[model samples]
Target: MTLSKKIEHLEQVLNQPAENFANSFKSDIILFFDDNFSENNTQLFFLNDLNSKEEIQSWVEILTSRFVMKFEAEFEAENDFINDYLENG
Candidate 1:
């Protein structure tokens, strides 16, 4: 997906009512610019305005599963740290 499209999709996910994020936290988004998406400076936002242990665990699961499925080794050999962080951080 294009950078803008990815951000738009993520925005939709982040804005979902079921997420139950703090209003102030919603505005404090953390976006990571990936070298893998250097063509468009694709931003990967793993988590945002998370305030509880459950949210943190949810973010970890979401990130780990997404990374393993989308960015498996062959495409990101040099970015092992990123994948590791996503899984273990």
Candidate 2:
């Protein structure tokens, strides 16, 4: 798949509900990267031809940072809800 298509797929996967936050999210993200690079040699070649290692690393870092922020926000929201419930109940 093209880079845009891969990104689109990633966004779709990210939007899906995770059954278990830790296992499901980690595995799904890993699987997405693995399938794109390892299983699809063409995509690996395309990336190599189009971008340098640093550029690719930067992209990965950006995505990772975004995921971290999202996870932190979700965790905080859940924690707040639980605390409020305990206090009120």
Highest-TM-score candidate = 2
- Candidate 2 has its poorest 10 consecutive residues by lDDT at 80-89
lDDT of 2 at 1: 47
lDDT tens per residue, model 2, 31-79: 5445443434343333433244455444444444444445465345533
lDDT, candidate 2, residue 19? 51
Name the weakest run of 10 consecutive residues (lDDT summed) in model 1. 21-30
Residue-by-residue lDDT tens digits, candidate 1, 1-89: 44445444445544445433232222223233331323343335443344444565466445545554555455554245344664466
Name the runs in model 1 displaced over 4 angstroms.
1-48, 78-89
